[model samples]
Target: MPFADSLSSRSPQIPCSRRQALFGAGAFLGLAACGQPHLDAGEGILRVIGPWDLGGFDPTKSGAMFSRLQIAETLIESDNAGTPLPGLATGWTTSPDGLVWTFRLRPAVLFHDGSTLNAAHTAWALRRAMEPPATLSLAPVADITSQGDDMVIIRLTKPFAPLLHLLSHTSTQIWAPAAFGPNGDVRNVIASGPYRLTRFEPPLRMDTAFFAGHRGGPRSVKGSAYMTVSRMETRTLIAEGRQADLIYSIDAPSARHILADSRNQIIAAQMPRTLILKVNSGNPKLADLRVRRAISLAIDRQGIASGILLDPSLAAGQLFPPMLQGWHDPDLPPLGRNVEQAGDLLSQAGWLREGDGIRRRDDQSLHITLKTYSDRAELPVLAAALQEQLRLVGIAVEVQINNSSDIPLSHRDKTVELALVARNYANFVDPTISVIQDFGRGGGDFGATGWVNRPVEQAIDDLLTHGDPDGRRRRGIAQVLQAELPVIPISWYMERVALSDRVAGGVSFDPYERTLRIADVRLAGGRS
Candidate 1:
């Protein structure tokens, strides 16, 4: 994927109240705040504000964003509970041997570029998805071939239970043949979906309109305009002013503030996401299992959840929240703060508290730097709380707030000691794959660094091979994590968005955290 130059078009960017965003001056920002449409985008456009920006034309990079907007789709789609639904691929079947699977495509589907979707093009897209760096590469896919104009067959090295579920990911989104260049690099986004791209400017703005050729609308909305607003403060003002129909990733403080506005409401849902401390286990100070355990024991999850996040139950008892059935084990002991126990553990690890109240083993100090990003709004605050809690146990911490992307970069370069991250396990079909990718073997960008447990690794392989119907394998992995404390779980996440009363169709949330489903909503009193 080469550099994607900025896209220029006549479509308008959704403005903010600050009037100083990359989207330009917000002269028409709060027009809809008064419950009326402005001059340009009309009453039908669903204007949205959020923190994520389009990475590029590369499907592997920014495909999830396209999926969230429903501008492009994958072969298979999933409901809130992860049940497979028909998208481009209407139906599929596995070979009796389980080594091969065939998918039947939906008939008469038209790409945005007026190209017909067939088995060949779909296979090409799937092959691209299997390339390195994409999530699909983790699967056992050997080859993808088109048997005919409508049927596509996938051959795997071995049987994978999550094959269909893997295809549901946006990375497998099929693009029109014309979307690719002669060198096979993705030049643009041209796919079959409910909407078509009207304009796109990387890192800031995107605009869309209903594709009349497809069989989707007369929907509640004709189109949507998205703008990346990184600051929670500016986003809250935009929502309070009704500048956007939907504003995503609102902070806890902003959510409580929005409740006071009768014309607006907070739309909240349980997300399969957990806030954890991404520990650099390779660091000499954190190498000992006792040191890591002491770090976990010192932090108070209950206090942080109640005071900072505003929900006591959100203080995660375990990494797997209750909503994540099969993964969440009730019998496992909950994670609680114990300062005396933490001090004891530190002493056992050869770290003795000195005169300055900071633990040190001779000259080596029990000190660490915690990296965090404000993308989720609660993470920086949580980092601060963790710092104070660790200080009580003579563990000194310095919190450094930086961009979310830096966490992965620092992890790769071995420069990060500890990072505060909110990880979404449901980004894939299930948490099973995520757990493996994160904590398995060599470790993932956001998972355990320089830490490996053979039993945990073996458990993941067992789940992959035999499939954990009773979740015995998953519980075993959890038990090891509870004892080892690779990454300390802080709290579970409830994805909250601030929506105006102007939005209709009940303001339902996509439990999968994929799409906002703007197509489902309309102006309060307007007909669909």
Candidate 2:
């Protein structure tokens, strides 16, 4: 990929008032000029800035970063539409009954440690990945074995249509034999990819260099120094100070803040992730269908998108975003603000308005606590907005800002009344898995807590096994979600990035966040 050299000046979803980066790019540049500690800008090293930190050595833990950086490769890669493509495995096939799958490995591929890629190594990696916590464990994988140097066989207990897509997960990234310790503890990331990990500082910085032995051949930039700057302000400063060539996972405010910089390019892609409000449907107070509908009706998604996200197009009317072509229902009624309807529903649910303006049922107030995190930066603000919005409908919402992990913890403990979550539809490569895992019999931590519609679950199940060519089953899943209001759709997500002018890029925004495709980025004056 050629580095970013001739990028056009694009406006953010919400244009900043030419505040000249109201946060002060001049101050950052001045500090850099004053010998403040800044980032790298060498020709050989592409300075990459983002919010993600290296979670750990395990793929199931945080291997997504390795794959995103092109430091690791999955057996099956995915296209923008989430279709399977050749990766470590050139091609693959299944038995007539779909019970057995065989993958023909790409030959002569060398790991960063100089070890050759083989089926035995790949099989070992897959088997290890089947351990709990990885989505692969969800599949009914009966056994895994290596036949020859290039062939790996996997037998399943039953036919699983999502097996291919499951393999596309970051947890399934093939690893070198030496990547793990004798007891199978992952010690390093030694995988066959365009980039290899040369330096890793847990939960913060990762430095990678291009591997000459990569099957893709030589890369444009010799390497990349990825730094995890969690603060949006600092990330904006890095983009303006020319400290980094590529900045990933930026927010709308940061995007708007840096939009005035003509020297860089703004890359915004609608992702498969959606910001949703997860409600505890099992809670006695929120279990009523009318109350749930009231909660949905009271939401002002358009106002949130425009005022907070600064992008009205990012407002979500349904559970699935437009990015998921088949899952998003075009004809289904969209969720919107209807204060009267919300109040009516609440009244029907036996909650009458009281003097405090909070609805009361038999002297019990219609009050709920909403939990959110600040990782995304917008969630806490959105939570506050939701609090105010619900207040108008005679519902009292208490906002609590906590760590991201607390949501799941509270879900498991059956203690959460409401939670603001950003659910990623492409987590399992196929969107159907999201429906199953989230709304299935057991339910997901970030999904509808204690809510299970057997018919919708079966519809999702049949979509995989029986095939839904007519999309009737898919539409049923969407309809059930819309009607049930198990998860209130708020806004869709956008992957915002700023590419520096020092390089020219043949860049593509990966909706799946599968790969950064840094390989195509090269020096501005370098050969194509």
Candidate 3:
């Protein structure tokens, strides 16, 4: 049952009238006037605007870049409904022993450079992903080889039930062999997706054009331009003024404002994420289970969810949200604020409240730095709220808002006392992969403090190696791990996407907030 065994694994559009006419503008513009934007020659190009900066074209490094994701297609893909479907590997089957998997590549599929999709090329991508000097966070393959012209076989040291889900991540996306240099470094950046990257601007914007020769032939979308505008007001203005065809990463207040406007239509969906505090359980002051339980009891999740989040449904009753149907236990006792009880627990633990309103044990004040990042636009606010909440229970907390990478950096340095983060459990459609990275051994960027649980590890391994599709046993194992206080989840997150009336069909929201069905979207005016 070792944790390693865990199964698992844009806005905007400008109307280009001339471009439309060249394609079919005269006919499509009439329909485009209906606020639908023409899908033919007369229609306009899609201008997408959002908050995620395009770090780079590297799929492993820059997750928010539509430029990268649009070009790179992974082995598996998921819809907004959270169902796992085929991607580059059109079909796959697992060995009865559960240690090997065979993937049947899509025939007639070609990369941007017109390279045929073959087993050898697919194997090259897999092998390159496993090699060092490249950090494709979700690479789980121990080895990969071509079985035939269209079949690629992957070998695993142990069974990983969530393997497919991991493959669905953009970080593990498949790129053409020529895309990388001899050292496995990304060079040409050629991908086999429905769209090809035409231009890339670091940490900001990207432009892509439809790959008509794509296996699926661009599905529904013709072409798209993605922009990274970190400022919320900018995205809002663009959406409202009809400058942007689509937008995302809006805060609750901004979302309400947009939804309130009659002209703009906003779509809000439940994101598979949580606002949780990762406690360093190994710290002497927090090592006691009673202390962790007491801290959990001292917070008012309902108040935070309703008052701060402006969404009462986000108040998390358990570590795992209800959306995670299998791993969440409906029967677990709800953690609620009870200051008196918390005080009593603290007193019993030999901690006494000082005159300054901070708990003291053995001459040490109960003060800790709660680290957070502002990339999400809400973590800092939540951290401030948590600061006041914890203070009510005699715990003094200092909030330090740093860059997103600092959380993992601090964790590695062991300087992090408590880290407030928004963890996305649906990154791979299965919770086990996250469980392993976050809770196993030394803990990943968003897991427990200097704490390790052997029993939880074994349970996860068992579920990965032998659990059934029924998922009950795996659920039980996840619940046991949560009950151990490895990570404390306070509120769940819901995904939100903002769209303009002109943008059509290209809009689908996923739990992880990833752009998966980009092909389904096209310019309002007909120009595909």
lDDT of the candidates, in the order given:
0.80, 0.83, 0.70
Pairs of residues clashing in candidate 1: none
RMSD of 1: 7.1
**lDDT comparison, 2 vs 3, better candidate:** 2
What TM-score should be assigned to candidate 2?
0.92
Worst 10 residues of 2 by lDDT: 1-10
* Model 3 lDDT tens row, 132-172: 43433344567889988899898887777777776776667
Candidate 2 residue-wise lDDT, 1-528, digit = tens: 122322234654344344645554654565468674555555677778878877888987788899888999889988888789998899998889989999999889899999999998789999999999787898889999999899999999888888888899899998899999999999888988898898898777788898998877777778888878776766776776677788877787767657666655667777889999999999989999999999999999999999898789888989898878888889998899999999999999999998889999996898899998988878988999999999999999989999899999999999999999888888777888777778887788889897878898778778767667788888888999999988889999877778777667436777777778788776685311
Residue-by-residue lDDT tens digits, candidate 1, 1-528: 111111122223233344444333242344346443332355678878888878898887788778778788888888777788888988999888788999999998999988899999889889988888887898898899998899999998887777777888878888899999988898888988888888888887788888888867577678888878777766776776777777888766667665555556676766788999988888999989888989888989999988888778789888888877788889999989899999999999899999999999978998899999977768888888899999999999999999889988998888889999998888887788889878998787788888879989988887776677887888898888888888889999876787666676446677666677766776665422
Task: Name the lDDT value of residue 183 in candidate 1.
Answer: 81
- Better model by TM-score, 1 or 2? 2
Rank order (by TM-score, best first): 2, 1, 3
Candidate 3 TM-score, C-alpha based: 0.86
Return the TM-score for candidate 1, rounded to 2 decimals.
Answer: 0.90
CA error at residue 245 for candidate 1, angstroms: 0.4
Candidate 2: what lDDT? 0.83
